[model samples]
Target: MMKFIGEAMNETMKRNFSECPPFFTPFGDTHKCISLFTPIKVSWFEARMFCESMTGNLAILDDINTYIQLLKYIEEKVCNCVNSKINKQCEDNERKLMPRFTGDAETCLSILEENFYYFSDEWCTVKLSPLCMTNKI
Candidate 1:
């Protein structure tokens, strides 16, 4: 059942990408396009792969402004479920130094619901929805 769901997600995403252009929003000094693959959760690595397949990568909130804008965007465009955690990109050293990090070797960054939707270090193997982004569009 999980494999079927995953396959269905990939097919849906591919069709969506081919039919509709991604909406780009202002991020710092450039425009960024973000896509949240929800209703299906996967590990950090899987999330990254999905984004890569779309010619993008996991979303990276580098500054407060970008973070705020993303939050607003998600609130308005995506579902309002507060229990959802979204995967994002993070550096190895950065994840390790986070206050809540457990010193896990395969930790990654995610927008944690328990952390008030803030960035938190979590095991890379943990399943979560992905927030993909691209600056090229």
Candidate 2:
């Protein structure tokens, strides 16, 4: 489902090299000044491949600010260009593709680790219930 939403919506802008991250430093300066991208609904692996081919890797989400910034940057060129609105709409658009929040009862299995306490539990919420995601049905 490589739906090219941005291009379909007639939202294409020149890429801003100054906005490029330091890791892509070399290409940004040597490459085109315009950095317009087509946001397609690609599977995780496809997305990784597309990004690697075009720029680098699938953008990593470390913090909410960066996430919001990128969403705004993409949406603004497409819509009113507001980061907040873009974030909200983008979230809504993506949510349609997400699986249910709860894990499947029988199919879900937990790994019996040697030490549960040793698990850092990076993104776990206050409760484990929020973590199990439903499949795309």
Candidate 3:
């Protein structure tokens, strides 16, 4: 039964990709496809695992230009004021409010719309939706 279910899921994925790829949005000139998972909230670690399951990873905005592009895309496409926290791979000096990732091993990076869409540090166990990106898609 599990094998059947897996096969069905694979078929569905193939069909869906043929119609509209999961990561259809082109992220700038980087040739990466990005998609925001908004339906369910999970911990930062769980979010990363989920993205990995989809053959992607949690978005890492390493540069200001990429950050701005993603911010604009989220604002225009997937803005949900009530649930605005999205998991991300955080680095130091990425945003004004971004905490030093090296300071706390238990903390993870996230983008919060309530915080003016700036990067913020939160416990890795905190629940948030994932912003997944993939180069192969």
Number of the top candidate by lDDT?
3
Ranking 1 against 2 by lDDT, winner = 1
Q: Candidate 2 lDDT, tens digit per residue, 89-130?
A: 433332211111124332211111123212122211211111
Clash pairs detected, candidate 2:
14-34, 14-35, 15-34, 15-35, 76-81, 99-134, 100-134
How do all models score by TM-score? 0.61, 0.34, 0.66
Model 2 stretches astray by more than 4 angstroms: 1-39, 81-137
Cα lDDT of all candidates, in order? 0.58, 0.30, 0.62
lDDT, candidate 3, 1-137, per-residue tens: 35433543564476535333454455667867676655447777788787778777778787899888887777665544324343122221222222123238888877776678877778877777778777733
Which is the better candidate, 1 or 3, if ranked by TM-score?
3
Model 1 CA deviation exceeding 4 Å by range: 1-29, 80-104
C-alpha RMSD of candidate 3: 9.2
lDDT by residue (tens digit), candidate 1, 28-48? 344666666554477777877
* Best by the TM-score measure: 3
Whichever of 1 and 2 has more TM-score, that candidate is: 1
- Residue 9, candidate 1: alpha-carbon lDDT: 62
* Worst 10 contiguous positions by lDDT, candidate 3: 90-99
